[model samples]
Structures are given as C-alpha cells and as structure tokens.
Target: MRIVAIANQKGGVGKTTTAVNLGAALAELGRRVLIIDLDPQANATSSFGLQGVEDISLYEPLLGGALVTEKIFPTQREGLFIVPADLDLAGAEVEIARMPNHLTRLAETLKPLQEDETFDFVFLDCPPSLGILMSNALAAADELLTPIQCEYFALEGLVKIVRLVEQVRDSGANKRLELAGIVMTMFDGRTNLSEQVVAEVRQHFGERVYETVIPRSVRLSEAPSFGKSILEYAPSGAAAQAYRALAREFIQRHSPPAARALEAPEQ
Candidate 1:
C-alpha cells in the first residue's frame, strides 16, 4: 500500500479538502482508500459524516497503545474508510513528544496496515503546523502530497514544508520519503495574482506540480457542512471535475505499470 500525507504548514490551503475529495475520487475509481484525519479540528472526519466520535479516534492510537484499525470507520462512499480525529488530538503533540522513539511512533503504529495491504492508498490529513504531529506523519508516510494555495505567501509555505521533508529524510526519520506531488488549490482564474502564483509555483516545482488545479468554489466549501465530498455533493460541477482529473493524474503517476495493466482489463 502507498501511504501519502496531505500536509501544509500554512492553514486555509485546502489540505483537508483535498484529502477528503481526492480520497473519494480515488474510491470512485475502485481503489480502496483510507483517510487518516490527524488534525484536531477533524474537518476530514466531519466531511465523511463522522462527528461526535470523540471517545475513540486517532487520539487513542496516538496517545495510548490502541491500534489504528480498531478506530477505522467506513464512510458513505464505497471502498473508502476513515480513522477519525477529535479535539483531544490537540494535546497529542505534547504527549507524543514525551514518549520514547516519539518521531517514529506513527510509523510503528502503521506497520501492521502496511504489511496487511489493508488499503490501496492511505491519505493522512495532517494539522497545519510543523509540530510533533506533522513530524510523525512525515515519518509514517511514503510520500508527501502538499496542497499549496494560489496566493502571495504560497511559495513561503512550500519552502518551509520542503525543508522539513529534507530534514526528516536526512535525519533518517524516513529515508524513503519523497514528495509525491504538489497540488495547487484555491485557484482563482479571474485574478492576476492567482495566475501569477500558479505560474511561479509551476516554474519552480516543474513536473512535481500537478496539472489539475483546484478552483475556489462555493460548492467545494459547502460540501463539508453537509458531510459530503465534492464528488458526492457536486459530482457534475467544476470542483468535482477538477478532483476527478487530479485522481486520474495521481493514479497514472503513482501506480505501477503492471498494476495499471491489470486494472485496464477490468475497466
């Protein structure tokens, strides 16, 4: 299984949005996907209609010796599951910091899932910070999927996350860690500033940046309130289409050739 951590140090960059919608999109393609909500806000958990599950959540696994699989819950979408998060996760950073082998705790916790091949892909919706939580996610993930907003400070946040990834890899926390891709989010076609930001990011990151850009849409923002992904809430809309394109690109880029060949016959 391929584990991807959707992370960005800066908030309001569509990190949770991408995690929910993209996971749903991948599920639509028949891939078994699991979204692990690591944010204290639990936006991704709420997006899947799983709120008020505070008693048993990611906090249990992060704080106690509870298995992550024990807390996993199925979403409305087929082939998709979620390990929800709660407000209690806010203290996890401090708690995890005090533990032995703290940096690799999440990795150790996820080893069983990795061995079991429970899901085709695992998307970690991380908090918007470079704290212990984010560090743990980086160590657990095989690759980082960063969501960068199309705004003035986009590059600044990107630089910080890139440096963190480098540090994690160089420090031997996760030697196999590499950037899977950078997704441009909250794009506004009408604004020159948004276009300039996308251009600048693409110029710097080149092929590492995804061709599918997530537009700023009211439907996209409204989906989470109704506890749905854009694919379920606005499947025929532009936002859903964008995420679908992103999933297609993601599969093409990440899936092995032999795997693609096997899927093609079924398709």
Candidate 2:
C-alpha cells in the first residue's frame, strides 16, 4: 500500500477536506482507501459520518499497545475505511514522547498493513502543528501531500512544511519519504489575490503543484457538517468535480504499477 500523509501546519488549508473527499473520489475509482485521522479534532473521522465512535480511536494504537488494524471502521463509502480519532489524542504527544524509539511507533504500528496490502492507498490526516504527531506521520509516510491555502501567507506556511520534510528525510527517520504533490485550496478565480498566490506558489514549486486547484465553495464547506464527502453530498457541484479530476491526476502520477494494472482493465 502507498501511504500518503496529508498535512499542512497551517490550519484551514483544506488538509482534512482533501483526505476525506480525495479518498472518497479514489474509492469511487475502485481503489480500497483507508484514511487514518491523526488529528486530535477528528474532523476527518466525523466527515465520514463516523462520529460517536470514541470508544475505539487512534489514541489506543498510538499508545503502542493496540493493533492498528483492529481500530479500522467502515465508512458510508463502500471501499473507504477510516481509523477514527478524538480529543483523547491530544495527550498522545506527551505519552509518545516517553516511549523508546518514539518517532517510530506509528511506523511500527502500520508495518503489518504494509505487508498485507490491506488497502491500495492509505491517507493520514495529520495534526495542524509541528509536534510529535506530525513527526510520527512524517516518519511513517511514503509521501507527503501538502494543501496550501490561496492567501497571502501561503508561501510562509509552505516553506516551513518543506523544511520539516527535509529535516525528516535528513534525520534518517524515513529517507524514502518524498513530496507527492502540493495542492492549492480555497482558490477564487475572481479574486486577483488568489490568482496571484497560485502563480507565486507555482513559480516556486514548479511542477510540484497540482494543476487541479480546489476552488472556494459553499458546498465543500457544508459537506463536513452533514457528515459526508463532497462526492456524496454534492456530486454535481464544482468542488466535487474538482476532487474527481484530482483523483485521476493523482493516480496517474502516483499509483504503483500494480494499481495501474487494476485501472487498465477498467479503462
């Protein structure tokens, strides 16, 4: 399985939204996708309509005793599954810090699934901070998918995350970790500021930025409150179509040969 961590230290950059909706879009394309909500707020978990399942959350496995697979819960989408999280995860940083080989806890927890091929793709919704949780995710992930907001401060946040990714790779925690792509979110074509931000990010990152930018939409923001992805909540909306296009582009760029083989027959 290809493990991709969707993270951005800046809040409201559409990190959780991408993890939830992109996973749904990928699932719609016939890939079994698993989303692991590592954020204390658990917004990604709730996005899938899995609220009130606090008893079994990612907190248990992060403590290093529970099996990661056992925490998996089915979501409303058939091929999309999730490992929920809750407020209890807020204390995990302190607990994980005291453990031996602390940064590797999550990686070890997920090793079994990597071997078994439990899901074709696993997306981790990391916390919005440079803390233990984020470090653990960087250590475990094969690739990083950062979502940058189309705002004035977008480059500042992106630089910090890019530096962190470099440190994680240099520290030997996960040398194979690389950037999958950068996505610009909340884009407004009508706003000169948004267009300028996208242009600046593209100039800096070049081809690393995705061409399918996520536009600001009422429907996208409302989907999470209704406990559904954009695809299920408003399939015909612009945001839904944007995510669908992203899924296809993402697969073409990142899908492994085995996964591509599966898609070939369908095409």
For residue 100, model 2's alpha carbon misses the true position, in angstroms, by: 1.4
What are the per-residue Cα lDDT tens digits for candidate 2 across 1-267? 899999988887899999998999999999999999999888898887777786677787878668889999998889999999988888888899999989988898898798887699999999898889989999999999999999998889888888888999999999988876999999998989999999999999998999999999999989998998999899998999999999998888776788878778563
lDDT of 1 by residue, 167-262 (tens): 999999999998879999989999999999999999989999999999999999999999999988988999999999999999988878988787
Looking at model 2, residue 14 earns an lDDT score of 94
lDDT of 2 at 253: 77
RMSD of candidate 2 to the truth, in angstroms, is: 2.6
- For all candidates, the clash counts are 0, 0
Against the reference, the lDDT scores of all candidates come to: 0.90, 0.90
What's the TM for model 2? 0.94
